[model samples]
Target chain A: MTDARILTEALRDPATVAQLDAAGWTALLAIARAEQLIGTLAHRLAGLPMPSAAARVLEDARASAEQGRIAALWEAEMARRALAPTGMPVILLKGTAYAAAGLAAGTGRAIGDLDILVPRARLEEAEAVLLQAGWEWVKPDPYDDLYYRRWMHELPPLIHRERDRMIDVHHTILPLTARVTPDADALIADSVVLENGLRILAPHDMLCHAAAHLFADGDLAGGLRNLWDIHCLAGEHGIAGVEARAVHHGLEAAVGRALRLADRLYGGGLRYGQGRDRDMLYLRRLLARDDWGRPTRKLTRLGFYVRSHWLRMPPALLAQHLFTKWRKTAAQ
Target chain B: MRHATTLRIGPVGFRVGSDWRAPIAALNDLYRDYPQPDDGIPDFNVHLFAARPWRRVLRPSVHIGGDFVIPDAAPLPLVQGLLAAEMGMNLQMALGQRRYLLLHASAVERDGRALLMTGMSGAGKSTLAALLMAAGWRLMGDEFALLDPVTGLIHGFPRLISLKNEAIGVIERALPRARFGPRLEGTPKGTIRHLVPDARAISVMAEPAAPRLILFPSYGFAAAERAVLPSETFVRLTQASTNYVALAERGFGALTGLVRRVPARALDYPDTATVLEQVERMWSAG
Candidate 1:
């Protein structure tokens, strides 16, 4: 077994440790190092409440602090490029927010470069602007640029020609293939600008984005953290009317899934406990299984389906998946 | 007001009353609530609501009621000094999150390309920024320079170049015309205040400009000295940056791509005067 398994068992109790072989103990020490780092981050998060889910979500942040640093540099470069006698507005996303939110050194996720979303109308102009500022098109391979331009949801990624920092300029959150759309202009119109003159997505929109990310992709690799983000947003913003809109977007199942995750993984004294306890008994059966068990995969796939329930348009969609998977296989 | 000014970053919402209220309210009134409603506040903007107790909030866009407590035992000298440090950091976060493409370095633009002087704390970055600003290099923020993610152009947020005691005198003599606020006493950075450059007052917030050369400057006490390093040195310099590792996955490849496209060099200078001369030479050659 891998170190992850060994440590999980060893951390349980003295009896669990005693039951392990020497190999298991070796794995246990490695796990202990990871745990020590996580524990340190947790200690930092404890000082700040109200985000509700922040403390638990950051448990693994220390492991990913390096990623956060790269993201921040690119973010700074983007802002610098926009400076004017009257600077234009800009906004940051994800990992940048992790550190900016003052959880620095504790934000564990590694971000390659800053990811940004500007108005679609400004796309070409934005690219030109970056070029004018000494950022160059790094796509020596024309195919890569074409792939990003035609297939992906955002522009080809960019890097600072001199500083060597990277940036991803996006107009939307998910890929066009995912076929999810949120009103971009509407988000821009509703954005709140900071003293620095950059605008960021609002609370409702941020929550929707996180939930949509969870459901549209059905990739739960970051599931626990994403759910925690949603829960914290709700708790801090008050869930009062979020559930209805979430349901309208076909996100009720995702919300339920996220809540179930919080209940199962976080364990005891959770902030999202209100009105969600009723779903636990049903969800427990869904969650109980080994990693390789068919039950777990089936349950996970079901959650993915429920989250992507909005993709029910045109019954001919079944042909699309076959063609798409075939295309992916061919490309590889 | 508490509910209104609270914003979220990551999993937390920083509120104003106990943390960031005053500045948010002030900015809200100044900006007419956000023109775009869907794009709510980002988590990177910091607001100082109460002066005493020095209650301030950081990245208060999505959540509320969070506070940044600089430990009571920590070594802080000036009340505004803490604010400046917090603001310096948060300003970059705001720019980065908003796609301003801000960077952690000392910048001064000559011709179209910006000569970035970079290094971590005590590497003499802030001192260089202040010295250049005083020497009429036009300010682009002392702690960080904002770049446009798309164009790589840099902007200037020329407020003040924070300085300690000795550098204050060094800058004062370097440019006698430099304006300054009253010295802020009692802080960790050792009785600091802003050295306001004449350029900061009159410069038209300067639009984002291209960076022609990446110069990683190292200061020493040896006799006046200067050397130009290889372009590949930028990778090491870029790696030395605080946030480079954070953006590696999605943006790191791009950053590497950026360095490949630009000319980079390391400069070892004994003092600010030598730095300015080399900067002039690099841009002139460009």
Candidate 2:
């Protein structure tokens, strides 16, 4: 693997650590920590003889990651308690799902805001119930609220009034206007119920949802982590299961592309060709480094930013949305 | 901004990069006694970048960024870039630190036991801490008290005491010969100055101390002292902590353990001299 791709390789197999020096380990730790993959790094690199500075950082990362996992579970419990009375079967999503379900991906995973999915029909009821239970709209802007409600996948994110924790309540995975629209009801139907009565998207469906989130729904800003999710999920359920489910759910191309990307970047596989390899390398550069580390030049980030918007909405609506957002900023 | 430098304060390390050279020179001059990050690894990063192109060339304003960044943070003028770098480092630790439970407090140590003090702004914690250091108590830190959740010991941070407003003059008069950073006038905190911790504090920063006493000091009050109930102490400490909520259970355990084991008091005094006397009395009583 080239320098950009080595970090991912190291994450997958701890044995790759022997090739690194103090400087290399230092840089890798910074990059991993910044990407919120340090827990996974620390876990993978466990028992390896390394510099004390790197070891201390890994220790800190492991501690933080464990705290995040515990906090993620606690947040899930709180949401279950809050929404249980409304009788909405709260479907956990993404990192929170991985944590709540105790999947391999959950181990050493750093969690951010809690994300949950409910039936679009019951979204309003869930919102009201959550509001009564002390969650308030984070963005009070009328236009932003209109945009999210009408076009986007989630509610204008709600934050706990007291805890200052954020929750993203989604009715679907992608925006309504996106090119691919998976059957969200089918997803809800196939969810696996956890012991505590929380529903998580089934394993195969979980992979598809993660793929849709990375390649279909949002910008690949954090594609490394999301793709690592694919890597972990695929490793556990087998690529064949995820690929088969992808074909069943009209996401074969997205899932295949995600798998190929993750594989080509980390594994010694020929799933993807050279022309696309360069782009993935550029993306890997952006994702592997700390914020102050190496960057994916302004033009490349701008390209992805624009491409993300393009993939999100149709060209015409995209223009109007960007203009309105810019105008709002100007007015402010 | 072209020059980059690395400095380590106690356990944490920082690499500061800037687009303007003034902030770098200021950091170099002010942080002369601090150890260079020679292990070739820094735990945190601070970048002082021009918020705008024009801001870099004329009437420069710096935007703070690093591993843990807060976008849209207000920009600071070039003169205050040192403060921006310090603030950026502090912000990263507050948001991203995981090795220890972080409390917004100042502490001083004697006989291997630490005296931790916390209060709201203008409460004279910094002043009282500087005074304590002058009276032979080793300054642990002025900004953060790093608490080990496992060992229940307080690790020394020993950062420069950022004396603000009237406290600057008060500390200068109390320690007539102590070294001070350039007097920065008209800051948001009004005439800010950095007082370098004594040589012993810097050298012995790696030592850890068990917390002996906790005080909630209030400045400019009629002479009054009260015992802080454990419940009040716990709540106030939680509120005073930077990472208490983020660290979750680990934080709860560390804080509750401290409040239970350490004695606490609320001190209300009219001036630093009286507070110093009260603190000494409290220490003796403890």
Candidate 3:
């Protein structure tokens, strides 16, 4: 079995850690860390017997995860306060949403930025309010700024000067130029309000958002964590009305591929038809790490890098965007 | 990873792997006196790998990676592989160590009491700690002082003392018989040479000592001394710490307890001889 598969197996069944030797634990920890799932793995294998070294590393992981959770929630609160004057109900998305709602998918998850969905009408007002509240534009380059304003789902990312944490103010799930456009207004309308008055997507919408993020978004650099989220959300909410919701949003294909891959990796007994060769290639791209945690299959990674851009924009726009980015990097 | 080795330093253990054998060989020789980890397992893993297949042979740049990494860190040439390994291990500790309140300080223990000297790099803390070790004080650590939040004691992490540039000449002259690693020139930190602490330091490394004095020493300055207020010490220490914010409440408690219990002073001197005398006077007065 591949070293990446060892990580998947351990995540599926934490009890398998008991049978792993020193080298097994080493490779497993390295892979889990490389995939940014060490905290989730630490949560899964918390009570299991393991080597002292592994225990120490996981103990640190759990602590760091707790720190991330605190930081994530704090950033959300800060954003809520900043946008309070706008009188808009801020819909939390992805990791922050799962965390604020106390979902299983968020337990020990390493969250990076604060993502919120607001009405597209108030995008300008929200950006102005956040800028006044010490969030400056992260992208100073005018071309990239223009690109984000025109074609991206989120505003140019804003970073708090004092706290140094980034907040991605997203209007919708997918970019405007993407092939699949999830109904943003419907998403905001269907969001469930938490005790703190912040909102999160309902179960089915949440699943669809996770699926879209995994399949329709950027290169699958962090595919394992995204798939882990899918597995947890599907297990808790079940795949009952998710298909209908995804179909309504034109994301059924992405959602279907996500569920099939999650089940294959984590063994939930959810069966689907034979996955396409392209989907299998995605799986290979996700599992392209060696035993020592170095990324192998360079050509496959490059292919997916191109494919991610292709999925986001049309061929003409893709060529233009790639050339612009390549020129900028080369000039540097 | 083609060559690997593991060693325990005080409360922490490290398993270092490398694509080339020279770095591991250097580590094995320098850490010969250090004990292996308790169960043939290490608390952290450090890997030195090439960015690409051809880079491993041509130019042979070694990128420092492990459980944690600083992406975009410039690669080191293969001849400086030892420096890369050392940096990789230090990087893991700085980023991943949450078990202790890590202070970017150097520490030494004498008479069952630890003296911690913390400041910016080139502030002479490392050189002072090395000189003290030669003067019969136990060298706790030179890079980081691991403060146990629960026990409120300073644990020893007597890895190699990284002597930089001019400090190398001072230490070599002071401890004429001390074992030294290869003198690596043109590193990011100018020239650096590693000094293995005396056998006594390694033999008693696991012992933790109650911190008795804190000093902020500055080199290349006029001889002057001033008491540092706890409030200012708290802020400066926070800035000096890499993991203070991550440790959160436990870190606050430990640091507050430390400032309340221990008196701190900032010492500036024109030369090492003057600082040695000042330290001796302060040690007796305390």
Candidate 4:
């Protein structure tokens, strides 16, 4: 069947849009008229990364008379939430901050859930306030619940009862495993509150988190985005004491690993840190190799294989995680 | 197969597998060809892609794919098309963020706050998100809004808002400079593209704003006047949200808070211009 036919049949299930191929997408965009592209880009701003097509469209609409209205709503909501009785300290992480902060604007990486880190003591109270306002738990699986309660530092996903937006509230990050425990508490304690009343992790901790997350993934798939986030955060926030702090916390290795992946994938293109320049070059060389068909061999060798070992354990621990994961799955 | 192993949306693809290799390969291709960057592709994030035989389903898998580069394929005319669809809804799950839940919905922003436009198939949500964005609203996303459960903040991933028919022309007339990528005639959504979101919206691209409003928009071109519903009523109106069941408890709490904190409304407008004016007023209210 023709690519169009395949896509047509797929659209029969709107869910199919989630599975479009690359070439299919190019052809699809090529045919869209100027205006239609704008509308589509607006709707998908949260679903995918920003591309030139969508960016161009957005440029033309900036001066539209409607901008002030939307901006007003955003400001008011920020104020209202601050007034809530349970108006706990919240930090807007990742893209949420990036958009407001004006870093990496327009890249389409759909934000699935709004992530907030609240103190564990305030977890119940926060959940209660949200429920009263219209937030609902998205999952009820006991295993999943246990995983979040135990291994994870957050709760199961929550969605807006009416608006359908998903959210994840957290008190900490990462499991308490030996590999991740050292920096967890420090991250929470050192977080910085934004003008919006949300307390986000410090740049050092945030970059470390991104690093750990990328390593856990085993490939450079998220390497570029994560690298960019780190670069921007470091550049914007300044690595002033980041190197010393990262070392003190023993997370320097994690940061190094992430930087290596980024250099290999993006060639250390964006602006970043002075302290990290050496590490960045080392990482670049580590990842640099002959680019074959997909760079699969090089990518796999970069970090996935070694990192997989970090999450591994002896039979007993292995059983524990598996059993824990299985039970969580069962509960869900 | 009980269901297709992969799901395609526009030019994105999502797959779930325990074996690792196949899903990894599939995801690599998906990410390689996707028109923009993302956190869900193979290289985007680490997911527990497993093939355990848990008869009792837990942790769901969500896949979104559109045109990833496909070489040697015969030329065909189309906008954006979905080649397949696969999702393991209501499964036990977690992502790298370790702090938020991901939902399937199109998030559009206005001002500094986000207004989630959610609905099922043919609800005109993608079209609506596109239209509003063209009218000067920020595009948080076309599908999936990553929300922080504690703060109810919305993250913006500005990319093309894929559209089908009627909505296409609707956006065209609203913003003359908008550019489309391509068009495929046979797809259900008619032609699709890496749609151009409003320039201003893109400018403020990755901001996370507190969600102020939840509007369930059902297209009725015949309506002569704009209708605003109470936030409470709008709460009940969104029962059609796909992830409501899975995320019901948390979703309910967040939605209720948003309505009480902000204002929830159901918007019914005949054209893009009217919708823009009505939404603008709602956004302006404190």
As for candidate 3, its clashing pairs are: none
The residue-by-residue lDDT of candidate 4 on A190-214, one tens digit each, is: 8886665656677777776666655
Tell me the RMSD of model 4 versus the true structure: 16.9
Best candidate, DockQ-wise? 3
TM-score of 4: 0.42
Expressed as tens digits, the lDDT of each residue in A1-332 for candidate 2 is 22334568787677888887755765676667556777887887888887677788888888888878887788888889999998887899999999888787887888999999999999999999889989999998999999999999899999999878899999988899898888788889999999999999988889889989887766576677887887888777775566567777778777877778777656634232234555564465345343345443556667666777898899999999989999999998
Better of 1 and 3 by lDDT: 3
| Top candidate (TM-score) | 3
Compared to the true structure, candidate 3 yields what TM-score? 0.96
**Predictions ranked by lDDT, top down?**
3, 2, 1, 4
lDDT of each: 0.50, 0.82, 0.90, 0.49
Predicted candidate 1 versus true structure: per-residue lDDT over B1-286, tens digit per residue:
2323433322222223223344344333322321221123222223233333323333232221111223232323223433343453354353323333345676766554566766656667778877666665765656666544346566654444677767777777877765666566765567675665454323344455676666666778543423444445545655444444444443354455456666766566777777778666766664
Give the least accurate 10-residue stretch of model 1 chain A, judged by summed lDDT: A286-295
lDDT of 1 by residue, A177-217 (tens): 55545566665666665445555666566666676666565
TM-score of chain A of 1: 0.61
Question: Could you tell me which 10 consecutive residues in candidate 4 chain A have the lowest summed lDDT?
Answer: A31-40
* Candidate with more favorable, higher DockQ: 1 or 3: 3
Interface DockQ of each model = 0.05, 0.51, 0.62, 0.03
Error of 3 at B185 (Å): 1.5
User: Comparing chain B with the reference, what is the TM-score for each candidate?
Assistant: 0.65, 0.97, 0.99, 0.59
lDDT of 2 at A110: 83
Task: Estimate candidate 3's RMSD in Å.
Answer: 1.7
**Model 4 lDDT per residue over B1-286, tens place:** 1222333223222333322233344333433323333322321111222223341134422233211222232222111212211112112111211223354567776557788766566767777787776656677777666565568777664445666767677767766777654444665345554465555655556568887776656666554333355554444534533334334455566555555665556666676656667667776763
